[model samples]
Target: MLSVALGFAGPALAWPQSLREGLFGSRPSDGRQFAAPPIARYVSEDGDVFTLDRTQPRPLLKFDNSFEVWALTPQPAPRGDTIYKNDLGEPVLRATRLGGITIFTEQRPGGSAAALAGVGSPLRLAIMGPQALLERLAQASARASRAARRLIPFEAEATPASSALIADSAMITSEAVVRMTKRADSRHFLDRILKVRLVEGRKASAQVAQGVLEVTVAPPQGLAGRPSSDRIVQVAETFR
Candidate 1:
């Protein structure tokens, strides 16, 4: 069912020319060119599309039109299957060894068969100059502010050696804001947040306190480091 359910794809192009059934069990088009982490796309019966990236320590899932990234925990299921759950311990999707998939959504609590949408891109951060990185950080900040419907000032101090980390740290902060805004349990916390600041540290960490979102980044872990997107959101949730 590669039908472009929505107009997201133009008339000239269709999504997933030959989408299969089991995305997780299939191999990528060319593993040699992209010697990177795995990514998979799945669509539900209600036309909900999501991409899962296994680049991070924990698998991360993100909706096509949303900025919120969810950290998923994989649990062993019966019949050589695996169940993926969100931070709330709610099972969101399940996969079998034989390339079968079933997803649980609000519309389908009993689970719907997930269609393998297409091959996903590797979760690789683009290498850019300092100015570009700063611009990207600013863009991410503005997006988060718009999503939260508030003026959340985002700032980061970057040294010559820590420019990329600083930009990524700011991005992580902005993503956390989006994540917080999406959840009813943590959305109110964004109202109380005034600013988000990211700085270099010996280790990565994030916390929300006193109307501020503080993020610290440690290099060496490079682009895929600790204090993931949802972890920062979870930190904001703790305030409430």
Candidate 2:
């Protein structure tokens, strides 16, 4: 019987008369009309979906796998706690800042549980200034080149620093590193054939401070002759 309340505010701007009538309903005979309250919905990590519609006493509706109605509860979450809602605006998670770490709780049936349940290991990354960050990127690229050579044994001898960097940055996967190296080789070949100067796109950037780290990877801008665009990757995490 877990219940969560989400307060939805009214629309900020006024709509045109025709559009307003369609959304808020027609004017009543008494010359008074009441706008419909906004509805909020959310899906749990376990895949439970529910919606909350504003009423005199708010009601929550849960749906099952077959889209059938499940449990309905009227319980509201404790005040002062910030509830993180889903795209539908229904509260699915709550977080509170403690001394160091932020505790996130997921709202579910029967009871609430820690959102970061299986995450026990502390993730750490070196803090680097602008120059160091650039140097690291260059070092990483050099390592990837050496690793690529390992794929084809006769090219060049792999460097010890490249091997060490690959082993240390467990944040990045070996497969991703290999893929990057392959792309680098392909770019080189394309440049040789097309005779066009193509710069290597910025792959990733990371910053760590005060136990919080943020990483961003720019979208891949494909080879010179063959242009391609991929989605950007961004991640923010907290560590001990």
TM-score of each: 0.64, 0.20
In model 1, the worst 10-residue window by lDDT is: 1-10
Candidate 2 lDDT, 89-125, residue by residue in tens: 4344343322011212233333333212111111112
Candidate 1 regions exceeding 4 Å error are 1-39, 53-60, 67-71, 86-90, 104-110, 147-150, 157-172, 175-188, 200-204, 217-230
lDDT string, candidate 1, 161-212, tens digits: 5666666666667767776777887877778888888878887778777887
Model 2, TM vs. native: 0.20
Q: How accurate locally, in lDDT, is each candidate?
A: 0.65, 0.28
Q: Could you tell me the lDDT of residue 129 within candidate 2?
A: 45
Clashing pairs in 1: none
Best by lDDT: 1
RMSD value for candidate 1? 7.5
Q: Against the true structure, candidate 1 has what lDDT?
A: 0.65
